[model samples]
Target: MKWLVPSAFMAVLGVTIAHSLVWGALICPFFIFAWVRYRPSMKIIAICVGVCAIFMALTSVALSGHESHLTGEEQRLPLRLAQPFKIKGQTATTTATTVKGESILVKVYLQDEHIPQLIASNSPAWCYWKGELERPSTARNPHSFNYRTYLWNQNTHWIFTLSNADDFTQCQPIQLTIREKLDQIRQQGMNHLKVVFPEKLQPIAKSLLFGDRSDIEGELLESYQQLGVIHLLAISGMHVGLMVGLLWWCLLRIGLTKEKVRIVILVLMPLYAIMTGASPPVVRAVSVVMAVIACTMIVKRITLIQALCLSIIVQLMINPVLLLHVGFQLSYAISLSLVLSAARILSAKSWLESVFIVTVVAQLGALPILLWHFHEVSFMAFVTNLLYIPIFTLFLLPSLFLLYLFSFFLPNVTFLLAGMLEKSVLLLDTFSMFLSTFPFATVVFGKPSHVLSFFYIIALFYMFSRWESRAPFKAIIFLLIVLCFDWFSSRFNPFGSVLFIDVGQGDSILIDLPWGNGTYLIDTGGAVQFGPQENQFSVGKDIVWPVLKARGITAVDAVILTHGDWDHIGGTLDLIDYIEIGEVWISPSSYEKETMEELVMKLQNKFIPVQEKLAPFSWAAGNAYFELLYPHDRDYEGNDDSLVIWAKFGGLTWLFTGDVEEKGEQELLSRYSLKSDVLKVGHHGSHTSTSQEFLTKVSPTYAIISAGVNNRYNHPHPEVTQRITEQGAVMLGTYSHGAIEYRFRGDKGTFQWMIP
Candidate 1:
């Protein structure tokens, strides 16, 4: 039996064992794959195990060496630029290395617009830089993306933010190495594309030729991602194949012998890889092709699977952490699936059938990875990829390549052609986006548990083994059962949760009912932005929505915007497009102001009710009861008139006072006597709210505050916290605890926090 497959899995299992136990749970498939596919001899199995043990030792040692070199207390450190600065408007980001060669992400406020141009024009690697080093932040919510882990996997542990761009150190001259020269050429090519093509076309050209996807518009990128064709926006296996074929034809046309052409292409491949940013997909494709070529040129016959496995082993040998990369995992997974199923693809009756077979196989390989990371799978991937991959492969990509070349020589003729190409792509993009709007285009399953993933792998392996052995396809039934079980598990869950999200300086709470009865969002948090709207941080899109989707909560029964404060209602509009909302509840108001009028009208257009709740306004959602307890008959003013909600759920009484200040609290006191099991501290525990009298009146068992960490406001003020403490209430602040949750069944509940 062949040894490459076992070797590949063993190497991965080794590194993963060292890096993360949860990730190391992947041992299930590797074991099953070896047992089912090969059933190798005991001696061969022993050899593979030895390889695994050796890699485990090596990975542990490497991990020790991978720790951040800097202590993160340094105020200034001279650094080398590892990549060109990427600047847009007033902010720029790049990767830089410390004197100790530890990479850190560098972000700077480009106060001087010329800074990027200045840095790019010089030997960037020789530039001097001084900045404060800070540790990266981990995810504050469960199932949210962990950026800290991402950086660590890339060997980046810290961040350096330049206070002022005007103080940038002048770059010195240096001899450019081959990689440096190639990068310079790449930068020049991208700059040329940026200048020649219209904005719509520039992203396609820059990404296709150079693997720089920084220019793709976020919405369009999301559309592509929803269609599972986002890989087209970067250099991938297809691009590599296209490039090699195009180069081979050109070299032969120019009178080069076939062997000479192979050698020429071999030499250019590495250069092309470096020039295109050496992303995992590019690196994997280039490595595989180079291995195949070298094998053929040396008259050493090798199967495509062997070449692919050889590339994986070599890449893992160089950097074991490469397996952590989503792109690398995806590349190998899809490639392996195609290779293992080559017979089926070859037996297809027509080209269309072949393409469909390939697409289905690739999607099957990519399914778990996508769901694990994103908590959702595009049901439309098969159709979207089937329809659009050809357009991209045949026309858009080639057109971009030709346009890029033409821009350097016949610069004037590029725009009209680029515009025409842009129009065509835009039309296709619009079509895909329209398809994405269907309610069932994508389905959220959240991330699978270790046990579920294990079974999933086993079932998938069993199914594949049956296909390979040309047996009855009954194994697919087990695969489908596992998938359906994982997908619909959340709906069968019986517990409920009232969670106070960590939305940094804002208030956003999720109240989810047991057994998928209902889901409600109290507030969608927002950040105060002083710059361009496009550049603003999206609390809804980035934070709140992730939390919602990760829990398999697809549609919100109601979105209650307590008041008009940016921190209270700002993210509501952003959430509208991403999640289905039944209605919106705002504080009592005339909706006369231009902003209010526009917002109400927009909600009306979507058929989502925009209602103003007054005192005595009560509603039932699932088994939860909510009653408005403040602003009985007054017109909505400012934060003082914010909605005060009294809710009873999971057999507990709770008060949600949204930014209501001392004045509003007094009115609430005069109008109603309140005692609650939980109190959401008003105005993020500002001094002007949550007064001692109010705390005494409410007499909550627990008081929770939502505020940013080390915020300018310094919320949960000492006096107010002292008051809550004096009232005998357990104090919890999002600032200190990240996200706080009171998970319950009937009346009994347990409190949990993401941080703790």
Candidate 2:
């Protein structure tokens, strides 16, 4: 029993970093710690080590087996539909299996909406599909998700793109397999659930009942995430327990024998697990119950811990890819903590005390993993879980279950209850959103260094031991001290940087002063929306924030918007909502534009200070001195009115021309002297900007351009590049390099490219 944790942990390592000898270090240290703490027998230790080796070998075999055959060329294949088509407007996506039984994702643009309706009527059980297969895209930025690695983890490497939806008409449909039939049933159940619940509650109902979280989007999702109770929204062990209890009660009411009830449950549990999407949590819950039932029949009892360990080993052995999923990691980690502390939990005198212990233990379990990946943790999570867990488990789940049962037979009753449920959920949602508004709900810790993460885990293990010993306060205080140290180190680090971020067809530059001086952004790159959307991507939330937070930057002294262009200022609007901000600067005339309306309102609402900077408005932040040099008390004239800035930092003179064109450049030369070691190219290096004469005047040694990859507006134009080249300046563009960074300590610095 003592060997279980080490064995399971090593299995995870075997799946994750089996190819590297470095991972053995992480394993060996843990083994020594476990030996000192648990004092397990030598034979058990050897067996655990043997188990690790076996899993490592199995993982190597599994991963090496999935090298892609897709050559990014059009090819015809008789493919069987692996999953139902998920249609969204003109486009739809699904999975298919080649005749060789290789899984490939299928993404298609529909000829018409009518195609989905027709396909739904006669679901594509199997089809001889024609498409172009290509490798999935990998992450292009630090801390961004890699869809290619994600697909390969699931033994899928190719994405089949169909030119037209009507192409499905070319193939004949074949009979469905048993598993396919079950999937269809599950899909139908989800649709039924959607129809039964109110529009607002559909996503929640689907998530709880079927583990389908696809529809759970937007601020409501964020609110749950902030509360750290997002896990409560998903199907877990509690849901499984409730379902089983409900089934057992119903069977007993029908006068079924107790033995017969157990048999029925055993037979139906796997079916239920399958129909509910078979998520990691769901599988763990189901496997444990089945294992317990089998053990009872054999007159041998299995401890809850043993059952849990067995499930982990069996699941990982069967599909090592589960190791890569965040959900899998969280589910197992939290569950293991609960089982290990079961004695303490059961010893609590009151239910409330038990709940508190459980919440704290679960938080401890999730902390290291969360910090390692997301770089933040919710401080409000404990409060939210204690308040909401009962509301969800005791009130919501039961009501939903009743509603689900009644929807089939009791229509009039169902309608009235559904309205009540929707209103109840709405009220909870409003409450949750209000809680999210608290500024300190979540604290950014940043991604920890490997050494720090190791120490944190070790400290957590020590804390768990103290909890088991009924002396937990010292460990709690110790943990808080460790957290403070983490924060202290992040703030006072001496390094400073000038980062040219990849904002895609826009501009964003970060100036981080040395030793906790200040941080500022020249622009917060925004997405260029073509039309209205249900949820348009936010560069601040999706791209910029991740990069910043990953680098442990949680506060900005000010965000200086070059112009009112959404591409330049739009991201700041969303960014200020999360990160701490002292002030925002814009061109004097830029604030009058319609595009700036939202930015101004959001900044004002957040009670952050805002100011307009013009020529002669010079300021110093630590050793960094900045001087505004353009748009002197004038009206906005679009790009030419961009707030041009000159600065001295890191032993170098710098110039940031915010989309200022040839005319504006000439004006700058006439009004002021211009020379810099580093230049932020104007208007993403458009030929309209960056005149040859202007480049000669600035005479920068390094000129960095920010632009999108294969953008509709071709930027960093050849003429501008030639001009920079003629000026004897090294030219770099975000489109080519991803991000261009100039890092320094005190007066010394070096330039680095993300791609390089």
Candidate 3:
């Protein structure tokens, strides 16, 4: 048991980073050194090393075939539906459904899948879908969520899309089991709560009771995250603690012995865990609580840390993949910190002081992982937590839980309780929103390297351990120095970069200036679907926001809409809503003006003025400048009238020709010298643009083509490719390389492909 936690933890870590051997190599030396210094018996040392190696091997073997099972020319395979096929998330045009059983996570995108109909008729079914199983999507850009790794960690390695009803090869419904019925009941409970609660309180109820967050508003959730009180939204140890305390008090009053009560609670906790979907954080919390109870029941004098270690070992043994979950790591990390420091912290004079101490310790403990995973820290978290924790724990949590309980067991009382909770939830939400608006509520940092993150953990633990005794000023200084180093590296680096973000068959370019002067964005990518559903997706929210937030970009100095084309300008409104914009510029367009006018009005509402018909001009700042080159005393409809921009910085010149065609290029060449070091290939390299005459005049060292992979329009036309090759210019396409970046300093520049 003593060795179990470390061995299991290391083995899981090994499996997660199976592609890298360096971690295991580094750990081996430490173990060998310890053995030599302590002079442990050779047999004991060998046994310890053998146990670790075996666990690692077992984990690797279990994961090795997961990918292969989905591939290798396997056109047909069997999949048992986990439960009644339920809709997970549905937009107007598409429905996202999960089919999980046999430790697999299969996302089935259904326009009309026969499996759903079959499951509707018969709740349990074994079905074979005819299609190649696709590997889940991996992140192709910085700070983007890795859906592939996430699914893999959840034992889901492949996705199957059902475009039509005929995709189903075979379907056979079997009788349901007790577990399947329980899952059905749980899902039905979730749906019932949504119907029973009011519109404003529905999300809060769903999250608090069932741990489902699909219904929460994006802006409200972001506010909670910024305020660093987002943990209140998750169902974790706090909720478990509340339930256990209530149950213990009730059972003892009923004349139950301590051991009997502990056993009863232990038995009930697992059932509750299952009902809550067995999330890694909840399971770990329940295990830890159970361990503590078992220790007390057996009259064993076990420290909280020992019980926590046991809990970790038990959870890992149940599911090794849980180690990869961020929630699991955070829960265990925070819980262990509290265990280690609880005695000292709780020794504070007042309850308020104790709460303050606890909040600070939790933040310090979670800081390293938060920085590594999120690339930001909420400096105001301690203060927000101090104020919010009591309201959330004492009032909101109990109210929500009681409502959840009464709604299930006594439906009559649900309305009154829900109505009361609704007001409290709204007030709490408003407070979070108000708190989020404060300057520097959260501070963004660069993603730390592993060594630096590890050092941060060590320094923080030492500081907390020594804080109440001697002053730990040195630790504070060390942390500040590290933070300042990262801040300077991110904000004051002399090399500027232009990132051509991959937004699939559309254009979005971000120009990041050196020394934190400002960032300029050209074109926000967009997609429009016209049908009964009329579903719209914005690249600003899905693509641009993640990229910018990851890099700590909070404000834009300028936004240039190349034209009124839907593909280029549709995301403008979303971007304005998600971030702060200084100025909006639109080029001369002979196209319809309704959509553009509406967008302009929205920006104006936010006190942002939109400038139209930006004539040929130059603006300089941050050691660089851009000159508007085209639309000079001429206006034509569509692509020919696209905005043209010329920028010079870091000893290099680049031109952004937004969808300009052959005629526009000719006029451009006739008007001025068109030489540039880098050229954004016109009109996504359509045959209609990048004329041979124009290529000769430009003589660009590199031509960048932005297009979608396997798009209907075969972009970078063969003739254009030949013309560029003839001119001896290298061509890079977003279709192949994902997001392409160019960094420059002095006369030297380097290029990097995000997905290549």
Candidate 4:
């Protein structure tokens, strides 16, 4: 009963944190009242208060330390904005500088920027502007200097970065001659070694070695997610634990004493964590495991739960922001659940029984949290875990150890071990794919509200706790209630309408009709001209698919790609592969030699029809009507050839104009009298499009802009925003609101705006 009070309060606190609030204001009073009314004892109260005070103090200290490292110049507002400039230079060297209590680093670059019109009256300023002794000259002039001062908010438009003497320091020039030699080796590896490896093996190699995933396609990532095997991609406690165990075994076999083996494992685990980038979650996991090991050797007793809690306290004290990180939350929550629940499961003598118990307990504990965050439940996760956990822990982890150990001395052994691991991975992948293809293996429910999610979690907890008791009946009833609520909630979907998803600096729109009649997806959000190597499909998988699944959208009637531009169609390939698309529509002019063409070929092999710009054909689903409005034969360039669309439901009208520029906008205005209740801004509201004249012609009451936050191009430019505002139109953007919806009330002759 005493534990329930704190547990309930902590659950509320967790909900508040997920909402991005600084504190749970509404729930804090309850916690305070509990603390006072319970009146456990002076000693217990003092200890709890002392712990909280220490935590707050530590957070304040960390934040203050971070602030002190910033330059005085950065603290002040800019006197003037400098013109955008590009510099050509390479990273010479980097060294971490400890300032106050925070880590600040200075990067030395041989840069070439024009002499400033106004220079600061400081010694370093002159040295920097004149390229003096403080400034080292390199092969390339005007090199860019990028250094980490503090964590930049990816969500903010204008981030303050450190400048001037407070945080900056000059370092010795690094020679480029050595860099040239390293470049040659990198090029050789890319040109030859990359070609020799099979395409499917690349993701495993990247995940195991560098933790990079630029090469893994989005569809495969979704497959892994559906198979409940995404944890394999991330370097987690399981991987580290396996490594430690392998190291201990090897040391003991080679004649090391028990104490020596423990010491070696402790030292080697941290080293491996560092090599893997030492993300906050990984660091916390390693620290907790190490502390447990230490306690076993020295103190002779310590509860795993206590060790985990202590590790969390240590991590939170170091960086309170980590408490807000999703990965940190998931890792700790899942691990803690296992620690608490695994003991309750009946102990078994057989190895298979032990494995089954562990798998079931962990999966049961993690399922609620997983479903709450992702709205996905893999029915085959238990079996998948049973099959892969042992393989991953025993075979793959040992292979990694062997590869690292024999790489230099017995180079051939590394390749042989890698080959075996690759083959094993291929086998596991095939099994996962087969399981994924099974009917009802994966279920996706739309996003659940906090209250519903809480109840669902309670139901799961109840079910797991009383699986072998009569209480299981109560759990089933609770689940049925949840299902009924979900069904009713889903009934309120804005069907037979077009929705502009707010996926900042990108475009993703959804069109839904009643009775599962017609579902159409316009452009999946993606960058057009930036980070060319980044696949839009991966973004679609991580961002779009989850949203769609949550909304109970499993199939699309038509995936209308406006053009071949990355922003317009980058995610189309991945979406086509993951979801059932009846047909694909694109502008004929978009047949450029790009990833889109490769996507078309893939779809063609699957017997999915791809249609180029057809005449303004009308399509109907119940009372809703849709018609293509542009991309006639006269249009040539991909941008101008965007598939303009008009949709009408009841009295409501919506228009979707792809990234058409001023010329296209003017042509549309000249050609047609476009009137709509809602409009999706063209070219992301760039100056090149969305002319006032065009907006006047459209006469839309609500305008939606799909763009990213703090985009490089500054999308939805100020002037464009001003123009929309001037028209007395309600402007909604994805950058601010994740996804926007509109529901038409036919009887009232009005519509409602919604954000989910």
Candidate 5:
């Protein structure tokens, strides 16, 4: 009945309305009814509902504006939103600002292209053209010599390209800023930390402070996740909460009055938040905490639920788009669950009881949301959190504080603290690494439909909330029914077919079976480590994990390394500790001894079996059959050591060649007869592999090339493509098409094509 609770409920309802509007007509009657029922005396509720209607109208106007701007016969508007632009005949001084993945924002100065005029005219807003075209002789020919390309959105600054008109047309240079001072300081810090800390600890410190994760490495990151201590690395609500609590405790210790202490805490929290860039989740937490404190002091009788609702409403008011953000949703949901479930948990006496209660409640509240957003659930997550939560609270947090506190005044003390923290992190990392290696430690469920996910959540809620009288029994029955449905339905799930994931110039294929038990992964996509600026380690953590989790696959039967090329094996180290990996197969001759030795040690510690070059190995699950084809003796170099695999199901055959070049191709030709229904083109369709003879022999109906867009190497070379075409092969490329899928129908043969 309270205003705040209704307001929060309305805000949530608003998001549902927005989503519904995208698919069907908005229902105005519900809003009017809610307004009349919830706030009989308030006119503002009607006004708010009116404003929402106005916003919806504006959204439609925006969509119409976009449609009106489009040319006839155009399926999609060709607008270049955020492209690097340069003017001809100018010595442009450029500087790079923020570097994210492979993209960096480079500010440039150029001649002939009037910057103020371009901004005023908004000519550069949706058009991306290199400074090569001579200024149009007449206004009528706006695109005569110019290439007027359209882009998806116009939200970023236009980067200027500087060169002669001719040269600039073909190539644009993105300048990198030299952060000499910061680099020197970071280098000094790294050197100092390396001397005092263990090899693994330095990366953690770098990641914790500067968001620089290049040194963290995949293996260590996975270990932290397996140990359930990954949250310790990122500056999250837990970290901010500890900071706030610590500051409050310190102020109280200094004999500050409660009122004064609260004021100081209020002022300091925002400052800390700002320093950390105040990401959405962090800001949400800060706002919620502040709202709770303010209500306690001023309102005197506000319930926690009311305060939480107010927090959500205020946040939504600030950024309505937050409703669509996954992090924002998870943060609020987790916090609300903690607040709602804490009283019940507090009644428990045993430490284990408290841990289990908290874990179960949190997971239960988060399960539906997690499963809704991500298809997979971590079965071992509860156990992992139970073990690592204490370590994170006691060891990691304290050590970080001590390290920072002593860093300036007592440098030696900081080093000592770092050393101690490093040892603890290593121990935790090692433990997680070992646990993750356990067979079936995690379970994967491929993504489910939104409707199914909704039902699953509803079922879980009914069971947990005791809306039904026999709560426990009903909950068990519901779970059993869901499991039974899943088991029965999985037999016909279309995603059971093999998927060649579009990982951008890298090999990563997922093989799903109808029985819910089969091999899941082939290779993990990875990029080369050229420098600190060009690392994709975090991409693997953020993007890859979410995709895998969405599909409900937590463990891969085997992670095929293929070879030691950075692209093939880069994400392997990360996967080993986060997902349950049964075994790792690689070519003995592909990797350097030192790298191989390190991997072997980690694998041995985790008790994961390692198989190298043991030829003609076969694995069968459900209706699918897998066989290892190449690396006879593992006495080869580079592409020759590539692991070639053959898979068959219901008269369909697929082959995966791991970056094998001409030498490997000739070797394969000499040794074996190649034939497949579908072929994963080797080395991204490099001319060196996929030789004419090989193509002729394989006679594949479909060929998939995993390549990046506009890569420097110009992969899937014209000549190689011509060869595949001549062989009557339908070549599907990841860069052009997103992900390629192949499904085998017993009598009809293989159905292969790109999925959206």
Candidate 6:
């Protein structure tokens, strides 16, 4: 037990350094030893064990980061249409998620698929294609998912892609051993359960039984996440505990002794782990249960701390990478903290009081890591959990599992059970959604700094240790209030900023004034698909809305429509549905097009102000003001009618030229003084726009282009690049740089890239 803390720290060190060694790993042990020395009896022993853990962690990380295969072993050849690419002993798992026509992501293995050999391999080498391997995409933007590290944890680095079925001539079935056969059977069982369950309840059942979440809707998933009872959906300690309890109760009804029941549970644990795919949390849960049972049988007595420490040692020995997972960190933190504070919590006078104390303790323990990982904190999570935990864990989960199990023998009864499960799940979802809609349901703080997170964790531990001391409690409270204020200032303080979002082939720009006075949106990107199976992504719903919500933006001061192009105005309706819009400004000739006319009508129906044929005007809104520059007093059509706006703030002038082309640029150059510090390059840097004469006239210090990566049009054409370079302006494109942001205050400004 004395070695537990060092072992846990070492496991974390191993995972953190797996990709590359950091100096912090070497320095962290001294701090751990300093803290451990407080316990006088184990002071020397703790130091010795801590040193040993550090060296072992370093060795483990070195091995983990080593390449899975030599470069020379990789196959390479020019692919041809006529050549037959045969795939043997390969198994395709999961339905493909169609990214676009002929481009789908499915678990198709072009490598060796012999089950035994694949299992024995250290890496997911068996999942790669036979030809040249391409690395997976990594997160380069703020608050984006890190796909590369996620795959790395699963021992998968490269993913296979095919142009279509034409790339493959034939494939052989996978070879499986007895154990592999059982695993396949388990997968089939999950598939069958999905078919038997109702549509809404299917995802929950799959998550509970097999941890499959591909079919879950994004909105529903987000609601569960906000409610903080999302952990109940994952098969972890609570699920394991419920199953064990049920088994014990049945055995007791059959007149079995308590010792015999414990023995049976110990035997069943391994089987259950295999069935659940042995995810980190599942393995941790099973290990903890086994340790407790073993301690009971052998030592005849065991404290919760001893059992927990033993379980941590066992799980880490099996797979040290688990230490890097958020789930592993949170699960262990909550469990250990609960055990440590169990006496205080259990002493509550009422059952409800006990539940509230337990919930608060678990949340307090997990708070630092949660804030660091998620960038948001659920303010009412404890209350939601009190309602969600009993219904989801104690009743709904058990009933669903029993229904799934009994469906095999009495298939006719599944529909009735599924109906009951579906109703309960829907009710829970409604409650979660309603709760999440409340003001300040969750606070998005962005990712906290490492220094800040470390201090918070230290303060939390200090308060727990000195709970009875009034001074320490007051100090911790003061620390929290300070952190909250810091977060508020970071987001809403007086500072002007512009974000050029990556919206594929379309354009969307977010502009904010200093002191939070105005929030303006330039355009909303869109997708266009015809025929059956139309593409269903909305830039407003998926990209723009989340960005707004995360920043606590509920109302937009103005929405400027550049033109009626679907790529420009497609997401506007969706955005309007989600957030309040002040007014929409359109060009004089906008009503000439049916699309623009319909949009105006829709806005009027919603009682939102629409200003068509709006003359060129300038108005002050905050520290800065905006001036409409193009289509002034003239009725133009098509690309020439695109609205051009100029904004001046903090001594820097920004010119936002929509998809305006050569003719429109000439009009602006002749009619007005258009020199600016920053320019949004026209027509996504098309050769037809951003003429040399226009570039020379504007002479912008910085030029920004928004386009998709490897777009069919190959935007930001060479001619446009040359023109911008001739003007001595630094060029930035969303295709290569992701999102580009600039923060302006007074005479100075700073620029950064999402990838950087």
How many clashes (backbone N, Cα, C below 3 Å) per candidate?
1, 1, 0, 12, 20, 0
**Model 2: worst 10 consecutive residues (lDDT sum):** 527-536
Where does the lowest 10-residue lDDT sum fall in candidate 4?
A: 138-147
Misplaced by over 4 Å in model 5 are: 16-218, 232-262, 296-300, 342-346, 350-352, 372-441, 467-471, 480-495, 503-513, 516-529, 532-703, 706-714, 723-729, 744-756
Which candidate, 2 or 6, would have the higher TM-score against the true structure?
2
Determine which window of 10 residues in candidate 6 has minimal summed lDDT: 95-104
Measured by lDDT, the strongest candidate is 2
Over 99-212, each residue of candidate 4 has an lDDT whose tens digit, in order, gives 232222223342323122111211211012111111121111001111121132111112332233332233222223333334334333333324434455656655654444
**TM-score per candidate:** 0.93, 0.94, 0.88, 0.68, 0.64, 0.84
lDDT ranking, high to low:
2, 1, 3, 6, 4, 5
Candidate 4 positional error at 26, Å: 9.8
Q: Rank by TM-score, descending?
A: 2, 1, 3, 6, 4, 5
Q: Supply candidate 1's per-residue lDDT for 100.
A: 79
Residue-level lDDT of model 6, residues 410-467, one tens digit each, is 7778877788779977887787788877776776665665566666666666666665
Q: For candidate 2, what is the lDDT?
A: 0.82
lDDT of 4: 0.62
Between prediction 4 and prediction 6, the one with superior TM-score is: 6
Evaluate all candidate structures by whole-model CA lDDT and list the values in order.
0.81, 0.82, 0.75, 0.62, 0.61, 0.71
Better of 3 and 6 by lDDT: 3
Over 4 Å off in model 1, which ranges? 29-33, 112-122, 125-130, 164-166, 169-171, 466-477, 527-535, 590-594, 617-623, 671-673
**lDDT of residue 138 for candidate 3:** 74
What digit string (tens of lDDT, one per residue) describes model 5 on residues 1-756? 276765565666565465455322233444555567656665766646555554445444433433222123322211322332322223322222222221112323444566524422232122223332111111111011111111111112233342233232332333223333334354455556556555657777656543345466666665555443455566666776777788889989999998888788777666555545455667776776676677666757777677678777766665555665666777777767777653644357888778766776666666655655544456687787777777766677667656765676777776766777777777766777788776655444555555565556566655555622434677768866874565345444544667666666677877767656575677787844332332333424543555566555566778887887767766766666456788887787654655665776787788888777656677887777788878778575866788888888756788899898887778778877788988899999887888888898899998889887677789989999999988998888877775666654442445454433
The alpha-carbon lDDT assigned to residue 364 of candidate 4 equals 61
